[model samples]
Target: MPTRTLAGRGRRFAAALLLLAALAVFAHPRIEAAGDALARIDKAALAKLTLDEVEGLRSVLELRASWLVAGPLATLERLARAGIPVEVIDRDPAARWFEVTIGPEPKGDSRRPPLADARGREVPQLAPVPLEQGVWITAAVDQAAGPSTMPGSRVIRVSAAGGPALAVAAQRVIQRVPAARAEVRDDPRIAALAAEVSPDRLRTSVEALQSFQTRDATTTGALSAANFLYDYFRGLGLATRYEDFTFPGTIDGVRVTGLPATNIVVTIPGSVSPDQVVVVGAHYDSFGREQTRVFAPGADDNGSGTAALMEIARLLARGPFDFSVRIVAFGAEEYGLHGSRAHATAARAAGERILAVLNLDMIGYTDRVPEDLDVVVDTASEWLGSRYIAVADKYAPLPIARRLDPLLRASDHAPFWDNGYHAMLGIEDAVLNNPYYHRATDRVETLNFDFAAGVVRATLAVAADLAQPSRAPAPPVGPSARTGFLRSLLSRVKLTELAWSPPSDRAAVGYHVYRSPTPHGTYQRVTGSPVTATSFTDRVTSAADQVAYYVVTAVDGAGRESNYSVEVDDGTIRR
Candidate 1:
């Protein structure tokens, strides 16, 4: 039996290599030919082959035509490598998959009927995410679904939740799986801050925003929502401003352009590094089908997100953080992320050091047992996503699904990502789960405020962590720095020793060391985390040829930090 099994495996390996060799000669034959060859592969034989043989076939297809790799070949490769029988999934009715496309808008007669979301509701044909001009094709796979009909595209598997990729209809297919969350690092200070996220207050804000009837960016309701937010932030004794922008585009064939919109911006100053900014934003605009100009009540679509943004702004107002926090309620997001695009463009041009952006969108509806949140990120923003999940694990403790895809750019966070800032979008994981999305029926009545509060608490914790809380003891004083040499058997190294007098406050627990090239320049935290020592020794690398500035701050038991101490410099340069 073993000898026969080896013979059978040897035959399958030889056949797969021969098929790959034949495919390499195509050099861009009719795409249908390649598609037909892939479609005609013997599933039984393919499944019997080892992963190495399957990879050989996949490598040849990728080399001959990389486009095929992202399309049918990707699905085929996944199946052959997983060692699952194609017939098993083919007969299962409960098996389904989801996909979305991101690329140039297809030209001419490309419009198709709206696709069904996870719950089998027909989702609208709006561009699901923010993009320059990419089309959104979100749907479930079945007899009607197959590979993307578009010419040029790439398919990235979302995860291993659903079985193999069913016949999908979009540019990319993502299977939902349990979200990967980071280990909890409980900090009492941040926990206290997150605990203050009031569900009632969140509902109040959502109710107010929804009462406007419509906030279609170009309508009077949008301006009203913006004004309401401006006043709310102003009442918090925070700095607030209005940024007007214009969007040129159309949604659902409505001319949504040439009209002015308002974006409300609030600033929470950082006591330490004011230039290092963290943005927490949500779109205030809403969209509906016909009569949308007057009756689009985007309570869950964005009123939920906007309210969360407002609540966080209110919560963080009492903070004097290590880094600045900028809360923005963006305008005209439904029409193509116009408000965030304008803001991101301006921030990029001005050379702002934005540390991260946490965008809240559609956080109020969930029909599942455990209400979960989805953190959407591209390759560049995965770190931000990880940090968010870590904070959620400790502060919010809800199930979270982390989705990494550049094509999921249908919200305000997309603009910041486009402008090269680290940003992540916190949204509901299930696509089209809200049956009332984009309809006049999308009211606060259909929202779950408790769920919204949980999402906001996670955002608050992340934002607060990035902008270190500054409500601790007074700053350490009498800071002094000295340069020394540590000689080793192999080499001599330069070190900068910094020391400071303890603050008068008895509640102080530890100290944080910061360094800067100039006295008033941005000071970077030198310690990985808070240090309990009064003196810190930093290995001197940049200081080899020039002077450096150092300062110290005190931290309390709750993890709240104080302002910077008096600036001190190495005696190498006169101050």
Candidate 2:
């Protein structure tokens, strides 16, 4: 156990607040030594503190939310007890070289060079847990209708590619999450399409993305990645477009221009209601978050998800659907889901009929844990999420686990849920333990293509079912719309309430709203059901949920929906 005197605790809390206040004061990333830290503190007021204790305080300031997890478990406990916000990510294979993750040093903390190993080779995610304290760091898959303790993995097996024996290293934590009922839908059509998901092809895509050097949203690499996706989707004969966006003070605390962030979209028009959309999403951008400038082979973090999107596109072109399916590869996910927010915000404003959003993120690294797949279902997307679990059991039965973690908003899917769109995530583990996650070594070598193939298949089953194969062509004419009212649900943070004038279409029974960050990009609906009234409040989530566009369309009494009326832009930001 670690010790924490009441006075020391108060001092530590004050230090954290000071750090928050000092965020505007600090200009340097590297605090040269203990002296550098003390120079900034008011030592005169803290006569009870020792130089050594102050060094530890400096470490706290430098480390901020990050932790150096290598040393002894005792040391780690002390750091945690100190209100350092540190976490022990994972232990290495041998348990000698522990992998650690330090939280962000306040927004404007100095930009130090990237972390390096003993050889001085800069490796992202490899950092020393500054030995400010003593020794002793504190410490510390599959959907196979597995043990009934976890959800089955989303996948199908066939002629080749059996993955390695799972370590089950991370399953202990997963077991704590209740088992979800898996109902494997025996959709032969889905099986055939899933069988088409190849490990070889998936591997090829990861390799191509890894070749990009870096996919940091603020760098040119992000745009390159977007363009690459745009071309690939276009090559598949899909109508693809780039959903461009901007990052305010969010980009490393500086206003960056030409951040070059965007989400790549491939739109497949619905045969009936072309406006009703089902989104298949994955973030394309990658970053080690290792250093201000670093190489992140995000092969596992998201390369696998992006590859799945590409392969899914190939698979979808083979079939038809009644609902529109838009394949979106988002940008700036590592930088707080910038691209998805812009897209989600616009979708709400336009009142697009979004059936569901299936976000695939970090689906490759199946290194540890036996639990096959973990589906994070928030309160909003429960129905769709439960079906996703059932889809795994029905069509591609695999072990699975479910967690109703509303705050598990680490990926792109959360933004949709925040905006009231039914969305969920298909991930390898609820608490991801890919040692190379957010690291330079997160390369193709560590990826399990066979497992990735399974995740892709699972997504296909659900998306295909939701989209539903269609033999009829879409109606050339859609309903028209007119605006009613739109306002903020909260103060000025982001959430908003909107009301639209009912369309003039006489046959229409209700209205559907569509939103997009831009006027041209394919729009997505934010409502779960058709709004019986002309007024609907748009509940936008704060982090990254900046909505701008709204359009309402009349839904015919026959259930047929119309084209959008004139689009409206909401400049609701008070500041």
Candidate-wise lDDT, in order:
0.65, 0.58
Off by over 4 Å in 2: 1-186, 248-258, 291-294, 369-371, 471-575
TM-score of each: 0.58, 0.53
Q: Which tens-of-lDDT digit does each residue in 1-575 have in candidate 2?
A: 12112334455545544553344133222222221111112212122222222222211111112212122334333433443333333323122122112221112112333434446654334222221221111111111111111122111101101111110111111122223332332447777887778899999999999888888777777788888999999999889987878763235555444455688989988765567788999998888767524587799878999999999999987766656899999988876677887898789768777878999988888756444887886543555667787777666666777665544567898667545566888888767678888888889999888888888888988888777665321222333322223345553344445555543334556767666543222456887777777666665443222324566666776676654554454543210
Q: How many residue pairs clash in each candidate?
A: 5, 80
Report the Cα lDDT for candidate 2: 0.58
The list of candidate 1 runs beyond 4 A from truth reads 1-186, 249-256, 471-575
Give the lowest summed-lDDT range of ten residues in model 1: 59-68
**Candidate 1 local lDDT, 348-425, one digit each (tens):** 778887878899889998877578898887544565787787788878788898876655667888767655567888
Distance from true location, Cα of 37 in model 2, Å: 40
